[model samples]
Target chain A: MKDPMIDIRNLSVTFNRGRKPVKAVNGVSLSVNSGEVVALLGESGSGKSVTMRSLLRLHPKGTSIEGSMRVAGNDVTELSARELADYRGATVSMVFQEPRLALDPVYTLGQQIEEAIMRHENVSRREAALRALGLFEKVRIPSPERRLMNYPHEMSGGMLQRSMIAMAIACNPKVLLADEPTTALDATVQIQILLLIRELQKEYGLSVIFVTHDIGVAAEVADRIAVMYAGRIVEEGKVADVIQNPKHPYTRGLLGARVELAHGRDRLITIPGAPPDLAALPPGCAFAPRCAEAAAQCITDVPRLTAIDDTASVACVRYA
Target chain B: MINLVGEPSPILPVGERGGPAQPLISVRGLLKHFPVKGSGFLKPKKVVHAVDGVDFDILKGETLGVVGESGCGKSTTARLLMQLITPDRGEILFDGESAGETLPLSEYRRQVQMVFQDSYASLNPRLTIEESIAFAPRVHGVPAAKAIARAHDLLHRVGLEPVRFAGRYPHELSGGQRQRVNIARALALEPRLVILDEAVSALDKSVEAQVLNLLLDLKRDFGLTYLFISHDLNVVRFMCERVMVMYLGKVAEIGERDAIFEKTRHPYSSALLASMPKMNPGERTLEPPLSGDPPNPIDPPAGCRFHTRCSFAEDVCRQTLPPLSRISGAQSAACLMAMTNSGHSRAPVQMEA
Candidate 1:
């Protein structure tokens, strides 16, 4: 399929900071082809962010990671410290949830963009500054020159996020990892940012992995949607198919919970319990406790992600 | 003076309460401005026009939604109603009596309670969930035992089993569970008006629905009024009977939920409605409904605050601020286009369009 831009196979991430070793991401397999936008959809503690962070190796020391991740031809897990540093922004870039906290307070937005450009390419300070201005223009930020000169706090939430996107794309990375980039902004500002990101992704032919908890956001941005449960991808398919016809019990419950203003919300179909703890996950399906149609097998054995068609899969016994 | 451009009617939809329902709270000319630091001596003193010239009435037993962007003064309005911050110029009337004079601020505050967005920061780490919920009632001289009983009853009503959860610390519960505790605490005072300022915004969609349903139930069971403030439009649409759309400290629109959502009059309200993410993938939004961030609230535009980003702006819009004028049965908009004879070329046609 023309070499997937970002490919991950049976990836698992474990955090050792606490007393117990928490397996945050357990055997997640995802791939995004060139110019494709795949959304990692999940609620809090679903390990969607943990899976995405593994792509950039953003986890801390003593965190154990297994399985293989390939992004723009560099083996992410096997990269040496020096190679990893060189490979980070130029090969793949990330946009975080809170741009205000993600950015350095003291440095002006211009300095940050310029630094990113200079780090990746052999460019002079003036060229980098010009490039930063170009990026601002590309992102449709008004008064680009003045805005670049403003510090992080000086800019509003939407403007700060636009600048963050500018920095993320300054290196012209093939893969873009946006981790709930619009979650903190207002709805109007969020749509503006989403359109900007989509436009930029198209112009650059960037393979993007967008992570968010909001289903509507996933529908708007993603070509393919992967529904994550406790540390595992329970369902994956074409965005429309997954959203319109969720197969797994967890996926169905999530879709059923989607209450729009247009629909008459009599009652939201809630998944009766919370996400399982990463440190103390039960045997079998992690979603078993909350799944309405959970069979006895769901509590006895973990279901594998079984493919239904070319682009559809569900990790449930019913689907199998 | 911020008077109505046209003769004011009951712009809001009639409350569910029949026969000339008394408003629980009436906030008139509410204004709160914070001074920007480091603007002394050399430069002109600049203040953020946070809650400038805001006016709205929360009718008894109804959920009046306050919706706007981050700096749009929805939160500020909530704080003003809760009496958490004093306004520079305004009068808050509780049941036709001026608070701090006839009604008394303490009594007014006792009838009103607030639940903030951050569930963790709002709760006391040292106290158990039951303690947190009972604190408000005990302070109001409800007696310790009665307050604790009330707390347990509220916890049960909010779907948290008191037997298992009452003794647990804030850290021991999930985010959804913690928020339930916050709700229980807000209700402990037996307040008439509860200001839920983004109370469910941080929650996951499934859990948010649960909380929303719970709020509706509590409102019905306790006969409480809610100032449901949120940036999320879908939740607001489902939860609120009437809505007030604010922009840069001004009421952009206020109306019945159906009228505002279906027959939107104000351009800003239309944009806000259009900004909600579509459920169907086939109908995903192609372009942003509104461009640019909500203009800097500090030193706001002289006339219309939203004129800079508004697509239908004209010189007249820049020259004079349009006050809220009733364009429909249940909707009022502060846009010249919606105000007939407001001097805008499209005002006459804009009313019917």
Candidate 2:
């Protein structure tokens, strides 16, 4: 295989919360290829967002990140403050969950878009404005020419989201990091936004790290899926391989838990217990208590991702 | 025509005691428009048509699921049903009486409960779960001890250990547990109609299922009526007997859950259904997701609001608004193509613009 666009090796992000440190992400290694969309699928506290944020060194001040985190050819972990600043939006643009919050309240939508463009490129205000409007047009923002001057609050949630996407793609970044980009949007809008992102990805040949709690959204856009559980990727494989024939018990539980539109479908199957607390993670498998198929070995040892088939890898003693 | 007034209350099945002869809640031509300043004083115009002409029946003891894309007015409709916001036009008949005239909306409030989407904000941080649950009953004249005992029973019914959770504040409980308290509080009044607006949308999948199952069993044992509103079609399918699909402040399609799911007639409904991710791999249809965002509800298209994005849109669709024409068996859709044998059929009106 050709060299991946982004490579993450043994990356760990630990948070110093007073007395003891909390490992939000632990020894996670993942990669994204050119033009591929990789999804981080897990529940709210799964550390997917932390891992993705670590790519750009976007974590809070107290969070300590270590190991090789590279995007394109640059070692993201080794970047100086000034170098990282230049590379931030230019190399990797992030689209957050809430568009309104992501956007500046004071600046007009047009000004924000221009700021994004001009951040990575030295251009006159006029040229940046034209480029911003053009990017807005690509994002399917209606009447991009006129709506550019509108405030973030003036725009509808859908339009604001599109504007965020427009801003993210402004620098022509090699990779896009979307942290639950559509979670706050409605279902139809969510679908439209995901489709828009997919189109932009194809058009730009950008590697995308789409983080979401929704497996459905992951299935829609991701070429590959990584099922994260308590700061680890327990299963990683092609979207079809993982979704169709899930090897991990956690993955199966997630699949079973999804309610389907089909009538007379059995009551949704639930994995017992809540997601583990990141601060006090269990000795072995974090999901063992909730895993219906958990074995005696699951508690004794932490399973590493082993190849189940040609295209699939799962971290489960049962699979091993 | 079934006179919704005389028809069995959508919340209650026929032959059940205390079940309304008509739907527990009958919303007819409900329209909610929020006035907004558009540009200037002379032309201070524009109405955000939040819930535009929505009509649905919530049967007693049955779950009526409302599914819509965001800003489609599912939440707005729930608010209107709760009478949290008064309708600009149309009538909300609760238990066969005009909600505004027959009883003080507050009295009806006891009989009509609501579970909000956000569990954290739903409960008062300062108040314990016991207090939150008892707040309504006490105001409605139930004695404190009686209300507390009742709240405890309700909590137990919702599967939360009442003794442990009773004294805990909303912040102390997990997302799922707080939601259970919300459910328990909503059921405290034994309301004939309970409107759960995206009640479990924020929950993890397992937690969502647990809550959904709890709701199902609650409906069975308590003979409770539910207006389960959500953006998720799968959850809607699991909980509801009948489903109503809304788009841009209008009811796109309403039908029995099976009929709507299996044979979706409306193009918008089809598009929404097509976009949902299916768990069964065998059922996957390799269609690239829906293309465009819904047209602005404020300036909804001349004829059908959805025609702009509808694959089967015809000349008549652009020219004349489609009526909620009956299809088969208690199902109807506001789509010209779904109403007609063919889009090419010559009619009094042409579908093309």
Best by TM-score: 1
CAPRI tier of model 1: medium
Which stretches of candidate 1 lie above 4 Å from their native place?
B1-20, B349-353
Against the hidden reference, what TM-scores do the models get? 0.95, 0.90
lDDT of each: 0.89, 0.83
The segments of candidate 2 whose C-alpha lies over 4 angstroms from its true place after superposition are: A18-20, B1-21, B37-41, B104-106, B278-291, B338-353
How many Å off is the CA of B300 in candidate 2?
3.4
lDDT of 2 by residue, B49-132 (tens): 888887777876678999877778988998888888888999987767888698677778877889998999989999999999
Question: What is the clash count for each candidate, in the order shown?
Answer: 0, 18
Please give the range of 10 consecutive residues that has the lowest summed lDDT in model 1 chain B: B11-20
lDDT of 1 by residue, A191-258 (tens): 99998888898999999999999998998988999999989999999999998888998888887776
Q: What i-RMS does every model get?
A: 1.7, 3.1
Q: List DockQ, one per candidate, in order.
A: 0.68, 0.43
The per-residue C-alpha lDDT of model 1 at residue B331 equals: 84
